[model samples]
Target chain A: MPPADHSYLTKKVISIGIVSELTGLSERQIRYYEERKLIFPDRTGKGTRKYSFTDVETLVHIANQMEEGVQTTELRRELKRQKSQEEVKRNMLRGQINAQFHKRH
Target chain B: MPPADHSYLTKKVISIGIVSELTGLSERQIRYYEERKLIFPDRTGKGTRKYSFTDVETLVHIANQMEEGVQTTELRRELKRQKSQEEVKRNMLRGQINAQFHKRH
Candidate 1:
């Protein structure tokens, strides 16, 4: 299967209000999460915050964990761990593809 | 190792002032957590709160979670889950002990 588009992960397509509705989190809570460095939504030229799909997904995950009494610092650590694991998998896949190409040549 | 004694877990031995100092939670926060039903400290006949070590530990845990932006309801659920798991383990252990005694007989 083709890899998912990275653009969709980053494209700021949702407003904060929509993000609140989708994530079941208050706008103030979203802003508080940003202040805690749990998420980073993009900013408009006028300084309004716009959220990407990634941001919305993160807020949802955070909400669930927060409900579980998980600490923000722990959540941040988990996020970093997940990102690192994904990077490692991506790198391993790239290396395998390169090796297969060389073998064919 | 023998199973840890449960008496120490429930024995109310500390004042709220000491709990506040030890747990690093304000007196008001401790009361609020009680109001939230997160911890149930014992009360004197005159109705002053007295904390067990377990209550102190739970407060510390709750404080950490609250810092992480965890919701109270979620924490309550987690607390209930932990209690249920402990009860299940205790029941299993009791069943094992009873089975061993019956086998010996």
Candidate 2:
């Protein structure tokens, strides 16, 4: 991938204020989420926190989950679970594709 | 996202050999795809190319498209188009969510 394509969603271009406006979360709440390691934002040269579009989406998702009474710890665990599940699924698919390719050869 | 979680799909863990095995593409073919910028792999400290599972999947997808007579240039364009469309969709969703939140406030 080109540098631009690679950074498409991960680029830290949006400021915290913009992210707060986008997600409807206060700067404090956003920082709280970062403290919990729920969203990872990049620091600018002056140490300003800058977020990506992915981070904004995650913040919105986190807020929605919190509004539904889910605990931060539980949400963290759930995210880990989901990520691992995806990893497993991808591995299985890779295995299947490899198997089919070998059989065909 | 936690550091580990953020690097889950982006980490360069699998060697090129493993990636070739998983994707059923020869090392040469995999390198060819890389030449086309269809996938990006990271270099190890020893200068060995290391791929993530995401890169493996992308290689498989690219191989399938090639088998279907898709040109690399065309595939690149399609990927760019898809990414931009996804960006637009995400922005629209964010806007809707923001509007809803403000309305509720």
Candidate 3:
């Protein structure tokens, strides 16, 4: 099978109310997280916020982190760190795979 | 380089005071997080809590989340969800690699 279609996770199609219901966070709280730069939702011409599946997950994750007593700035830094670490790991894996593939040929 | 020796991340050798300083959380806050089941620190015979590098990271993550207004219970659930999701993704990637390797042979 082909790789899973993860586009839906990034497609900004869900509304803030739905995201709130799905994430168990109030709409106001979700907006606050956005204000804190923890999540970025898309905005329509009418200026309404639209979220994606990934955004919901992020909101949930952020909420979970906040519940643990993490400050927003620290959380932002941690998120950035994790993202970079994942990128590095992905690059290293890609290099290894390319090396192995070339060796077989 | 032999997988970069990530064992230090899991080795329980750091003290609570150090962890507090490293994560920018108070010793009492870290203990509170532990009480809320957000972190698990090893204990010495004298009842001192010894943390790993991973634990320090976790404490920082938890604190960051708490700062974003996530409740402890929600954070726990989100952490569990992320762990399982990562496991699933790893398994899928491993399976794909195995399949590709076998096909080449």
Candidate rank order under lDDT: 1, 3, 2
The candidate scoring highest on lDDT is 1
Tell me the spans in candidate 2 whose CA falls farther than 4 Å from its real position: A1-7, B1-105
- Choose the strongest candidate by DockQ: 2
- Candidate 1, B1-105: lDDT as tens digits: 554644545555456765776678899999998998999876766787867666777898999999999988999999899999999999999999999999999
Residue lDDT tens for model 3, B1-105: 233533546645556765766689998899888888888887766787777667877888888898999999998888789989998998999999999999999
Q: Provide the TM-score of chain A alone for each candidate, in the order shown.
A: 0.79, 0.79, 0.74
Candidate 2 lDDT tens digits, B54-89: 677788889999999999999999888999998899
Tens-digit per-residue lDDT, A45-86, candidate 3: 678787766787888898888899998999889879998998
Q: Looking at model 1 chain A, which ten-residue stretch has the lowest summed lDDT? A: A5-14
Q: Sort candidate 3 into its docking category.
A: incorrect
**Local distance difference test values of all predictions, in order:** 0.80, 0.79, 0.79
Recovered fraction of real interface contacts per model: 0.00, 0.00, 0.00
| Estimated TM-score for each candidate | 0.45, 0.45, 0.42
Model 3 chain B worst lDDT window (10 residues):
B1-10
